[model samples]
Target: MTDTTNTDEQDPAQAEEGAIMRFMRATELDTRLLGMVAALLLIWVGFHFFGYFKNGFAAFLTPRNLWNLSVQTSSIGIMATGMVLVIVTRHIDLSVGSVLGFSAIVMGVLQVNILPEYLGLGHPLIWIIAVIAGILVGALVGSLHGFLIAYGGIPAFIVTLGGLLVWRGMAFLIARGETISPVDSTFALLGGGPYGAIGAVGSWIVGLGACAIIIFLAWRGRANRRLHGFKLRPMWAEYFMTGLACAVAIGATLLVNSYPWPKGIVRRYAAANDITVPEGGLFISHGFAIPVLILLAVGVLMTILMTRTRFGRYVFAIGGNPEAAKLAGINTEWMTVKIFALMGGLAGLSAVVASARLGSATNALGTLDELYVIAAAVIGGTSLSGGIGTIYGAILGALVMQSLQTGMVLIGFDAAMQQVVVGTVLVLAVYLDNKYRGATK
Candidate 1:
């Protein structure tokens, strides 16, 4: 009656202004991050096309390679998210690697040695309790670091440096210079090898679920922005980007799902174990590793905590100007403690994933990983000086780092070169951040 169709068509462009503006703002803020993403994709393509063999697909781009690459990145990816929060608050956690080793040892000891003798628990329940114990041990270590830095007023670097030694020593005491292995099949799945994989079907389900959630959130965010009178991108742009994202998501799922397991290998494997073979020639695919899912979950939580909550606001405020935040009545010290605690928690999760993946626990479980985690965070565009970072970017940074490592392996390059390249990348990232900040000032 009131030309409603015409009105709708006419106002649709304006209606999406809020979403468009927000997207643009984020893009502008994350220009470097976008560039890093592009760089990662380029590496993926380049390594396959240019490096080593003239194989059908680039070596690194193969389904098995990609699947393994993702799993390799998972542990550090989890830590990188938490490192984002710590770096955002202008703090650092130098002991995460050691804590990971110590906590992992705690988990392993509980599952293999302690439980059999004392609790006599079996299967899923023991696995569950062991993981919780690992996490708790990690939190305790984090709380101690937090207290020392926040309450005792010791410098964060110094306090965490001390923790680096103490935790590693504890791990040594736990393991006594021996590798502990033969973990339960269920417990081993957490580490993400074939035994730990969710398989192809499970991977598809997870990927689809993740994609759906992302799209729903994007739509809801746009609607909220429009309601709040914020500017947004045009509807066309939103749809285009969203479509692109969905395409990538589905493509990734297919790639992982299509990696063919050798028929002979499956047959022999079944035969050796006297297991029944299905009619469809094994009907199996290694979909996604559970650790990847865990990393995704941690990444999402970190992203939300850093972007959507009061704690996030305070973190930025304190990082930007501690004195000003304190003047504004924020509990800066306690917040610092909490941030470190979160970092410790993620490190604990990393231990769980790493220990599970290896099917063993050793004192050297997390050796040098603190450096890896820090470098990933910095390369992802988390500022060392603080007040800036993103969990997604940090996770991507971990991916990029692992990509380089995996590519080198595929190409048969010296593994030691990884440290050289990572060091260079890290130095370059710090230099760029400093330059950008200076230019801005």
Candidate 2:
């Protein structure tokens, strides 16, 4: 007994190992995000070759393709941001597609059919009212779902599943199995169509503005942390991250600006106007579609909500442990209601964007969209078990998934193979997450 030694403290290797473990634990989330970036790069490179060699074209990496990807990703990206919140609270909304479809149908009917027929409201006024009304419809539907689940004591899965069928049936009845066309031009401007494009100059200006804001925020945050005596990342690390963010902003702007107007379209427009081509004018296509801006706006707001607000922390806490949360005086039911309502609202926004992009609304508007929205969030590293996700990562996940779809089509892969690959990737991603999560624990 007198000879007992403190082997734990005496072992030099133990200190080094403990330090390494601490660093690993601190960096796990950052590591996962970096891995996602690397995976996206790999996917892009693989698809670039597949499309170029297999399809005998190099369109996959062009600015035109990139711009299209951004637009296509925006719809799902918007919905996925909300889904991250939903799933983080250990809930899901299977009815988002149907909700989206019904909202768009309501807006189209009001704007194109009822408003003009009954009230004769001005075009701008009709568009404004229709948008607000559509969003309210979404919020209402979301509240209904939230109420049924929160107050009625039904499981979220069952509640939203029922909503899926009910809302989809309602959409069919509302549209009478038809499509509505020639949407209000004013409203369509939000859809990333030609009317919605933020011209090349505007895109550059916005990008620079965003970069400046990002830099300012970083500096301010670091300074605040120092003032509070909080630990900070290495100064060099902060500098590198800020530089990287700026490079990405500038790079994306340049990429979009590189795409010239399609040759046939340019010639047709020029001929229609009886205007010369200006002797070698580049005729560059517009940059940064409006939908991209919408996504960015939503993303910024969501990032702030998740990273800087008490509501976000409560949501995570509720997800991680409901009973523990209750013991700590959390009102989980009310929070769940709010979360689902928010999801519904986002679904409505996606509906507006979808309808605007197509310049019409149909009963089939958002069929299967729920799958894509959920996949985007899950693939972006949002754990299905809840309490973890990020808006930016989900947005990137949408882009990556959409890129796969676009690339597969370019390489002539059929729809079945696309589904198969997507399904496999989803399973693999979830498995990896589980393994990584358990190891960290």
Candidate 3:
């Protein structure tokens, strides 16, 4: 009986050791994951409080309002994805907003006039052409910036800053200072319409597919690492994280789609002798935006490129130690150029989406876009000195910026105050990031 009791005590201790080991392994597997999640939760809580104090609890997490917030976030979020790559490589592209604006204007022109008249395109087909054109234009602009930066010895910041002005000027020239009104219905659909509804559905499908692919890849990667005798997180912990990620994705989708139709309505009585009339209210889904899907796709692709590719590794090397990377036979210059080109292309895509949503292209379309993009990247944890960053982090940063903008607007903050607040946040984020890095070092 004494021997049996001793064995029982040993078993419990063993179990506790095992549990502790598992927790430690998980903590090591993804150190930043918890912090990132915590940051997001904190942002939500802050927003919730702001809404509650200003407009009561119901204003917080209204389904329609949530959907609007997502849509508003999409545009900047998409650009930030590309900005992540540029920042990871210790570079910046200040011209992205201008590039976006230019691309959008071009797409609008094509959709409204060129496609219908020259290409004989239908509604959806016109949208396809516009998207294609936007991407191509973006790529070309990026390549130009890359060429100047990589080969001409021009700083990326300078080149892109010049590009910001050049492109804005070009936009004015293209649209002649007029707000290219009466955008094609087809093009409008690309911004956020019924196609946007289709886009939301598409987002779910893609998210699921991405989750599956990630799980498979992660499992295979773990197996390979183990086989090669590399350090790896335990299998169960990895699976748990993967499951949790998938659940979050699914939950987000459901939450965004939960609002009732005809979200708000109003009634009017003409006069004492006149009859009353009821009119259907404005629905949030009515403005459901497709830009969100585009941003998601861009984010996913950027994450894959950053985390899974050799090019991504080279980017880190270049950022961390350019001289060392060059000595090690990495094509540093070419890579820089390529990165810039890629950024330009992304800018173009963003511009197109924004333009479509606005249904017009104007000289002011991309003004100060570079500042926002740069701020987003820096806030997302991309080191200004280069080397360490993640695409997902940039996306999060962009979302935070977007949320701040949205919340401020909802709370009736003016443009000047918004700018002041954003600038302050950017400074604070940079200070915190630098402090964290210094402590870690």
Please name the candidate that would achieve the greatest TM-score relative to the true structure.
2
lDDT of 1 by residue, 109-149 (tens): 88888876765656567888888888888888898898889
Q: Give the TM-score of candidate 2.
A: 0.91
Instruction: Give one digit per residue, the lDDT tens place, for model 2 in 21-136.
Output: 64554333377787788888888788888777777876678788788888999889999999999998889889999999999999999988898876574556887888888888
What 10-residue stretch in candidate 3 is worst by lDDT? 263-272
Per-residue accuracy of model 3 over 241-335 as CA lDDT, tens digit each: 77877887776666665653442221221333364543654333232346777777788788878878989888989989999999999999899
Clashes of 2: 0
Q: List the residue pairs that clash in candidate 3.
A: 100-351, 138-345, 139-345, 142-341
**Candidate 3 Cα misplacement greater than 4 A, ranges:** 1-24, 27-29, 121-124, 199-211, 261-289
Off by over 4 Å in 1: 1-29, 53-58, 262-265, 268-283, 433-441
1 or 3, greater by lDDT: 1
Q: Is 2 or 3 the stronger prediction by TM-score?
A: 2
Rank ordering of all candidates by TM-score, starting from the highest:
2, 1, 3
The top-ranked prediction according to lDDT is 2
